[model samples]
Target: MPMTVRSNCTGTLPSVIAGSAYTCSRCAEPHDGPPLGYGTPAPAYWNVEAADQPGSVLGEEQCVIAGSYFFVRARLVIPISDLDAEFDWGVWVSVSEASFERMSALWDKPERVEEPTYFGWLSTALPLYEPTTLNLKTKLHTQPIGDRPLVELEPTDHPLAVEQRTGITSARVQWIAEQILHTNPPMG
Candidate 1:
């Protein structure tokens, strides 16, 4: 199932006060009016291979996560060394950029950042993971096609990467680039 809102929100789903609420644009249930008792923001927290280097970092992104669907805003890349033919590497977590900025300003205080609050990778044969839903889309070089991100895949690329790019829309990428990210959740 697509993610939903857990907070008991009031007013329109994305009210002027709190900006916009995140959800899986394709599969998420609509919040017609106020008092949103249950909803799911796209997975906001993620640990992924550093986009520029060897180490990993915790990052936030705007993306969708639902049964079978594993899309993220950032172009997630995993090193060939990290892939395994038989393993279910868990899920990556992330948040929106707005949330990241909010938390950054209040970084000095440990209690300031919130969970799922408002708010990369490297290597050759790198597999790029992009969002496939418009409502959950982020401002990236690649644009959205209908509800899915516009990404190109090559048949000769890494088998797993090819799989992620070609398999079911929601098929899980066996090699998760985000797991090696933050050893501990960022700002946790």
Candidate 2:
């Protein structure tokens, strides 16, 4: 595929929000809407309280530093189908465009794509690891100490660790940690 640096924001949004209900002058402009590329939305069940509400774009930024082409920041509302569920969480997703598109294409389709390109939860607004240290540590920690990967994450007191304890999609957190592991695996 030819990688043209063409800056155009074009993709499928929820059909429900296609018209005046969600119309914005920005949508017509390339630079105004979320950066154009492949991506997916946060899961529908990320926020249980906003069952009736739709997910909205909070912001987006190109992030070469993090290794992703772009990151779509969104406020996901995971609907509460369980009547006993007490409340919902206000969470953000830092995801790849390819992942976002997969979710978007299945917005109202009968067959939905369960997997996205990649994404991670914003367990907390605070930075869990410093940029410089994160790169080095993710590489070291994901390595195997014995039979299992070390996973000796630094600053264990960080909110991300708390998110792990609370079951806020630790898979996503692991995905982020595994980036380095996948990029540079052990040579045997």
Candidate 3:
């Protein structure tokens, strides 16, 4: 069932104002979401644009948490000798330039400067209980994608000389790179 509203001359849902709300005409999905209660309203806060059909979230999905410690583990190239991966070793990832760009568009806000992490990496062939650091240098852009201030480093720089690091592997990186990017477009 389509919700009725005063659309604009363009025939699209016009921008709604304060106190505005939407609901299904037949079953009526009461619009009982959160954030604001009185002063303002919901739609403004619930600006999740639908894609495939309507009311779908995955359309702009980025990260799908897998409930595995691997995904959230502190991303750093801890050397195999230093780690306690007695029965652990896989890979890890969080966010980066490419990933952050897409996420920023949907979130429509700048990420906090103090955001815990900014990179990902792969784990060693073995598991460990504690983490270690790799002297093999890394980098972290002082700004977001469009270039603000980028920092560079050398192999000896390691943690002190690097900005942020991760545990991403060459294979996993290739797979993820393929998924996020598109290769072809149709002619109009």
Candidate 4:
């Protein structure tokens, strides 16, 4: 199912406001406001066959597949040049068992924010990028108790990495929304 891009902005605006509404090129639905973020429900490795596999666990913030594969949900934030708010991708990253255990142990503790960043591999593939997003190197920075970890891409020449480092324009954000909205199977 496609994720609904809800309006994060407050108050109402007149439809006449230029660029206030975005018409999805694929669905033809007019989104009233810019989307602040999108997220995946589960890691790409958690396929239908893995759904009921034993020794596998999938949770809102963490996941384990076959007691070998470890994953954590994280936020990949991109600054929008023209807006105060950011564009975020709620993605998953594959971590080592040791890192996963440490994160799990500190999951409910506020002090977890003090922990060092964990090395991880991008486990979710984002849409609209030329090169596949999967397997990208990342550093997962733990946040407060209630916040998701932040996934920082390694400094590289990838378009996503460049966007994260230099920021993207509002027009780029709109283009992203359109592409993701129309993508088959939908993007998080």
Instruction: Give the lDDT of residue 50 in candidate 1.
Output: 24
Model 1: per-residue Cα lDDT over 1-188, one tens digit each:
12222221112123111322323233363322221122122233322322233332323323332322233333322222322222211122233445434434554554442323131111112223343322321222222221111122233355544543444211132112122211212121
Which run of 10 residues does model 4 get worst, by summed lDDT?
7-16
lDDT of 2 by residue, 37-96 (tens): 111223222233433334333233212222333333322221213221111222233344
Q: Which candidate comes out best when scored by lDDT?
A: 4
Where is model 1 poorest over a 10-residue stretch in terms of lDDT?
A: 117-126
**Deviating ranges (above 4 Å) for candidate 1:** 1-149, 168-178, 181-184
Q: Rate the local accuracy (lDDT) of all candidates.
A: 0.27, 0.27, 0.26, 0.78
Best-to-worst order by TM-score is 4, 2, 1, 3
Cα-based lDDT at residue 177, candidate 4: 71
Query: Which structure among the candidates has the greatest TM-score?
Result: 4
Which stretches in model 2 have alpha-carbon errors above 4 Å? 1-87, 121-157, 163-188
Clashes of 2: 15
Candidate 4 regions exceeding 4 Å error are 1-19, 24-29, 184-188
How many steric clashes between backbone atoms does each model show? 18, 15, 14, 0
TM-score of each: 0.20, 0.27, 0.19, 0.86
Deviating ranges (above 4 Å) for candidate 3: 1-61, 69-92, 95-107, 111-119, 122-188
Global CA lDDT of candidate 4, please?
Answer: 0.78
